[model samples]
Target: MEAKLYDGPMIDAHQHFWQPQINPHPWLAPDVLIPFRYGDYSAIKREYLPPDYLKDATPKHNVVATVYVDAEWDPKDPMGETKYIHTVAEKYGMPNAVVAQAWLHADDVEAVLKAQSQYPLVRSVRHKPAGALSPAEAQSGIRTLMSDEKWRQGYALLAKFGLNFDLQTPWWNLHEAKRLALDFPDTLIILNHTGLPYDRSAEGLKEWHKAMSLLSDIPNIVVKISGIGLPDKKWDINDNRWIVQETVQIFGTDRAMFASNFPVDSLCGDLETIFTGFKEAVKDYSPEDQHKLFFANAKKYYKMKI
Candidate 1:
């Protein structure tokens, strides 16, 4: 018998792609990488594409399609991998909505949006945080370059673009992050990697809950149940009980969505393993709720055509 995919569009809204051999970019430090602890990061192989996806992940887990989030630098200009992924997604007719990076510097964001409009799936914005865990290329300088007035100006530009803001910082910054989301209620903010909570110690865990709870109240903020592959044994992708449960309690299915967060997450488990963990956590949830976590909510959040 032929396998049947998920009934509705099983859209994995958050996944990435990069060829280390071809790209040779150290997106993150290998020392701090979670995949290295689980197994050799090099053993995982170089770059991940759809074929790698099929080999590693099972269809029964139900991923009808995916939306590609930008995985590389936004180019010195706005149009680097933007054109490449668009070509790939368009060829297979993948739903393939992309979260393009737009530095929030001054009125230049308007130029970023104009560049985004060139592609159909360029539906959102992600500015690589200036000083996250890595220190490689200079960031867009949009966020820091913009003063309060500049930020206020850039915020309106993002809204005018009808773009969602993808926040890709360590979850520890939730306090400051909360303010950013609340300040821009009009811009739908998707928190990446569950805000990357650094909840290893008792205090870290305690603070994580409090910070997350505060952010939950912000109506514009939604949490992504993705990128749980921490090198730290405590927060490994296979062990996502606390992150999953806490997220459900704080954001609920209505404001939360599950993501493959693959290739990057491929650093942890295969796509199927990630989905197995995802479905297992939410299995007790009602079908309606589970549907929301897996598919519906992402569609609604990103305004996806599916």
Candidate 2:
């Protein structure tokens, strides 16, 4: 399915830029093995800066701005990752918003939030909670993260700092995500990677859909329609159309936005294919809705002035 170009001003709701030489990203270690959902990531193990990203994206996309979600760098120095991305934004004039990593359970949680919130570009924090999944449902990498009281306390601080929460969790944990959203009604929740429907079987899709429907009840929770390539590793536009449609149908255009999930998704295909695939998926929608998905919603959610 060849994708038609969408020549619209777009905002990559989610993406990353990392320099491994200067920063410690344990996940990028040669021996590290990501799950099949991410396919093979070796091609992206090298440094990926804004210039490299623009080289791939600008041909097909008019990306006026982007939101740099934290690449899982060394947890020891989360602020270092934020500082580096800020410099990248300064140089490249994109990635206008920064979602830094914040371990809600850290002993110095308040202090960490204070420092991160000090930066105007730091609009949110991407904290992949351990989750409250059962032993049977929990995968090898899943941890019991958000259920902790201390972490919940740390999450509370986000409101004080006027920061949103960028949540990346699997479908199995959306129920808990719903609980958190209701608990923090004041805090806006942005669900990453299409609720991370890692399971692709009929039953898996059913579960993901159900979880998404439940989460949709909370008006404050919004979805980022990206990373469908994770489970659907083949990257067929036809195959992705349903996921994109179902996502918009559930969250609606006002609460749903498009994302590149770049470099990581670059493993599946190029940035051109990713955005074209998205435009193809949503072609049936009205232009106003398409504009919201491509640009407006992200500006509102991340508060990107551009």
Candidate 3:
């Protein structure tokens, strides 16, 4: 019998806290005049900060703790996103965990890794999703960057820095991800959102599923079953359970885990609804597997000491 899952020993492997007003969030590309405003739910309202990150996110997901992902504090900034996250994670003593952005140009990789030297909570780095482009196209771009010799050199540095790479990309980018995995087998690589694609009517879902299966072939890469307010349709996590469950079928329990991608995902549902939806989505799995999806996997991936 499958045991019930009650938000087990959970450390939210993914969650963001940013405030355009109070904190640094310059990448919030808004569409105020659209059918509905999009990009960065934090823009619609102040989010990902003390009251929300500490008070709401903690209780809502039944989160025993959280891994603070870098909010991409503008790629152009000299300070870089790592320091910003380091400051906040240190300020709140959040989750005793953190994931900062390395966002290297595939060339300045060493400088990027060395930049985060002091921040102990800085556990990982996110290379933002090249979602708009197809995997092949992105591969061309990434390879162009990697072929620079210096870029290939960067991969070694990231692996050396003891950092994890959270690929915040879409389904189309999976192939390139696999390439990265082959090149750096020792580095922990995570796929955020089961590889988001243009999913309105399962148009590319079958293809995406195949891509995910291929991605799982790389032992070091894990999948994050989270993302929201993305194009193709569902409004909230509750409405999106089918897709999440489908993703689990492809990635399986050991390779996949739950993440709230909060504030960003807040565009769809509050933390309660998010957790409720996730619980519903995975409730049918075995207790041990369920534990891995909701918590254990994240603890291991990000090396969260929680």
lDDT, residue 148, model 3: 41
Error of 2 at 138 (Å): 5.9
Report lDDT (Cα) of residue 110, candidate 2: 95
What TM-score should be assigned to candidate 2? 0.93
- Residue 55 error for model 3, in Å? 4.1
- Can you give the lDDT of residue 194 in candidate 3? 62
Clashing pairs for predicted structure model 3, backbone only:
17-48
Candidate 2 segments exceeding 4 Å error: 1-5, 34-36, 132-143, 230-233
* Local accuracy of candidate 3 as per-residue lDDT tens digits, 76-165: 653555566667667776645677666556456577677764467777777564334554665566533333455456656777788877
Could you tell which candidate, 1 or 3, scores higher by lDDT? Answer: 1
| TM-score, structure 3 vs. true | 0.83
The order of the candidates by TM-score, greatest first, is: 2, 3, 1
Model 1, position 119, has a per-residue lDDT of 72
Model 1 Cα RMSD, Å? 5.8
Best by lDDT: 2
TM-score of each: 0.82, 0.93, 0.83
Q: What lDDT, from 0 to 1, does candidate 1 have?
A: 0.68
